[model samples]
Target: MSVLERFSFNHATAKFWDQREAVEACARTGSGIGLWREPVQEMGVEASAKLVQDAGVQVTSLCRAGFFTDPTPAAIDDNRRAIDEAAALGAPSLVLVSGPIPEGGTIDSAREGVKEALAVLAPYALERGVTLAIEPLHPMFASDRCVVTTLNEALDLAAPFTAEAVGVVVDTYHIWWDPEVWRGIARAATEGRIASFQLADWITPLPAGVLTGRGQLGDGCIDLKRYQETVDATGFGGPIEVELFNDALWARPGAEVFAETRAAFANALA
Candidate 1:
């Protein structure tokens, strides 16, 4: 099969799209999808699961379920629910964006909180046959969005746990700037810890808040083809999810955005 055959569209690429419509689009294109928790919960997890099953669309990975920067009991319980949802949807991985530095806490302390949270949830994830994919967000988000900011840091946090229960998410948007990204990918592959892979271009003059400034594929300076080859070299023949979080894209109709992104993905690789 062609590399594009494994293409999966992440729903967040068009944030306002209808969940069912997104799934239908994926099914129509023989593509997979990455779902978000809020929409899944809104539609009811069981019903959402049934929708994907009926549509014959694979749920590549759940958007996220990790904010245990404090590892509170409530936090653990919430994550347990996320794990259950992933299992029900037949999604092998639940992406985890370790929460930001807690109030009065440093980045180091927040990372420790992530460790504690993972320790408590790893067994639960293992039992459910779902991997908690620790996603290292861009360092720009370190203080308020995520403590984990690099593939190596994510791998280090996951090292204490079994690969089956804990792993890492390699998103080009987040790690493309790192000089050691190639080595990071190699190490992640060697350890069998690449739980999820996503693509989002790094755009310049980031937006005001910087949370929704992701550029469309081929719109930025990132070498998309190189990333594809690097990941493929690792023997990770899994779904390649496109998860652009751009405000402009989100403002457009989902169908339009999907078509454009699908084409962009093909072109970027070609």
Candidate 2:
């Protein structure tokens, strides 16, 4: 199949786009979608699920559900809901952004909290046929966003659970700077834990910093093709999602941005 067939457009790439239009566009192109929870919930879960199911759009993975720094009962409950949402939507994976270090907690301790929270939710995820995909944000985000900073660390965190129950998101923008990332990709493949393979480029941030710095595919300095090749070499034949978070992209029309991203994915990996 062509790379476009394997393309999955993540919703946040065009943050303000209408979810239904996005799904319809993906359906028309025979591509896939990575959905975010807030919009899904806003549309009503069952309604959103039915919309995608009817559209025959592949739900690549649910956007996010992992902020268990403290692992409170509330946290566990919310994650459980997220797993249920993924199952309901026919999504295979639930992307997790292990949240920031909790109040007065050390980074190590927060990570441990992720382990604890995963232990509670992995079985739930496995039972529902969804993988909990742990995504490591760049280290700059360790304090306020995700504490998990490397693919290796995310892999290590996923180690205790069965691969079907937990896996890692190999997002190029976040892992491109890690020297051992290629090794991590191979390891994820060997372990049957490459739950999602995402694409984005690393570039200097707009005024806001790391979160907004994901350049369009090939727009920045990241070797996106090499990353794609390495993951493909590992035999991970799954959706390659482009998940950019640039304000500039978000400001454009969703249809225009989606079209550009789809073409970019093909050329960057060519």
Candidate 3:
């Protein structure tokens, strides 16, 4: 009865730039990985898939697909391609970061757009056996990155879709500050909507733009064990992915970062 099997490392943890090294590192650690789209595309989806398979690493989830706040036909089309890639990699879910409000548009309008986009792509995702995981970003990213800022909001958005086609990515870093987070986690479990569960510590005086300021495990003010306990209490036995977007960690060697991150993750769970 341990959370180790539930642990994974997001490629973004090592840095968004180094793709191959990150995969190899994850392989060395005997953990699963959360892959980003750009690297997969650059290395060629088939090649990347082969690399991961050869390394014996499980791909927990694909980093993204769902920036369709405008619900453009082209956006939906792109998301379809993302689903194809996720299926190709044998990943169970494609994490979706619902896009922000378009200029002159309200958040409500943006959310509606997300609904429409999901309607368009969810079928395709289901066909390919890829679950679209709507990731609720921090409220601070509500404007430019993702409007889905709370677990409740993400769950509400996903309520209309089948769990096979759509679900949610619960990242503790983004949601640890929410007053109603535990309730949301329980709700996700009851609804069977917990597609992915990730981790990252939160730091203050966030850097400018604030997208990459995530702290390493135990470096900030998050109660890591409480997260594990809460999610486990709900019978959510999914991979606990560590997805840090810290700039400093990115500057170090991938091997060092991987080892340190794995240790940090173990420490947090311990």
- Best candidate, lDDT-wise? 1
RMSD of 3: 1.3
lDDT of each: 0.94, 0.93, 0.89
Q: Who wins the TM-score comparison?
A: 1
lDDT of 2 by residue, 1-270 (tens): 888899999999999999999999999999899999999999999999999999999999998999998899998999999999999999999999999988899999998999999999999999999999999988888998899999989999999889999999999888888998988888999999999999998876444655777899988899988888899899888899999998999999999999999999999998
Global CA lDDT computed for model 1: 0.94
Measured over all alpha carbons after superposition, the RMSD of each candidate to the real structure, in angstroms, is: 0.8, 1.0, 1.3
- Local error of candidate 1 at 141, Å? 0.5
TM-score for predicted model 3 compared with the true structure: 0.96
* Model 1 root mean square deviation, Cα atoms: 0.8
For 10-88, candidate 1 gives per-residue lDDT tens digits of 9999889999999999999999999999999999999999999999999999978998998899999999999999999
lDDT of 3 at 173: 88
TM-scores for all candidates: the values are: 0.99, 0.98, 0.96
* Clash count for each candidate, listed in order shown: 0, 0, 1
Q: How accurate is candidate 3 locally (lDDT)?
A: 0.89
Prediction 2 global C-alpha lDDT: 0.93
